[model samples]
Target: MSGANIERREIFRAIGELAYVVAKSDRGLTPAERQVFFQIAQEELDYDSWAAQSRFELLDEVIQPSIDRAYNDALHELRKYSAYLTEDIKEKVMTVLQRVAVCCEGLSANETFVLDRVRKDLQSLG
Candidate 1:
């Protein structure tokens, strides 16, 4: 693939990691949260939906990272692709994350905390 396509896919993969982090923050990803994650991935990621799903599956079913590790890894990828994370993209990401957070049992304190940190981190990216 072209370098631009590779970078774009990596960016979406990071978005998936962020979704997994939020969904697993409270007490692991519930069925509802997983559904919301996939739906939001399809809606928000659009052309890059497959990249996001691939990363999410890797984390959820294989790697199963800790919250801190997941968040850090996602942040790393976002930073690597900061040029593409325009305000509109950032807003879409936050929207999906918040949606996933409250989809099941409502947003937990942990989810809120992670969301806040994610917001701050993304804001600081550019």
Candidate 2:
């Protein structure tokens, strides 16, 4: 694939994984959380939500990674594509994560912690 396409895929993949991580942080991925995740992804990322949704499905169905593993994997992708992580992109990323965290119910402490770490990691990219 072309470099641009590869980067896009990687970034969206990370977004999907992050959505999984946040949703699964407390009480597992609830039906409401899943719905909100896709909705926010489509609303926030537009066409790119396809890649994110694919990754989210993969984690939810196939891999079922641990929370730490999911977070680390997404972090790795973000760092790998660090050049593409402009401020606007980071804002969108956090928006999706934050929205998902509060979607099904109030945000859990685990979600709060995960979001904080994600925010810090993304901020550190600059």
Candidate 3:
């Protein structure tokens, strides 16, 4: 979670925020979705920080306070790092989001819209 990958970790943090946005968009996040969300997030954010099969209660601790505000802030944070981001990083971020969006009951309309915005945000960077 340090050294050369610091920026990548920051991007992952933003992606985690976006994931919270999507999960909360429906007003009800299933236990199954939360599990998958953490899995995908850990994989993209920094797999090295956790064990290969790590799972704990703290994994369910991401709180999405103001959906719109947090979502916009996360997107803005990613966009702010556009110049520092590599193509590979952006792809991984999107992949983490998309992978979780498909878990649970699949992407709801709100989730899809938010995800589309995230995709556009990443794509518009370069």
**Which model scores highest in lDDT?**
2
Q: What tens-digit string does per-residue lDDT give for candidate 3 at 35-116?
A: 7877776766566324211212222354436778767777777777666678887777678778777787777888789888
TM-score of each: 0.94, 0.96, 0.76
Candidate 3: regions farther than 4 A off: 1-4, 44-63
The RMSD (Cα, Å) of candidate 1 is 1.1
**In candidate 2, what are the lDDT values of residues 1-126, reduced to their tens digit?**
799888978998999999899999999998778888889999999989999999998999899999899999999999999998888888988999999998877889999999999999998988
Tell me the tens digit of each residue's lDDT in model 1 across 11-51.
88988899999999899887777877898888877888888
lDDT, candidates in the order shown: 0.88, 0.91, 0.67
Q: After superposition, how far is residue 79 of candidate 2 from its true place, in Å?
A: 0.8
Residue 23, model 3: lDDT of 73
Sorted on TM-score, best first, the list reads: 2, 1, 3
Q: Lowest summed-lDDT stretch of 10 residues in model 3?
A: 51-60
Candidate 1 colliding pairs = none
How far off is residue 56 in model 3, in Å? 13
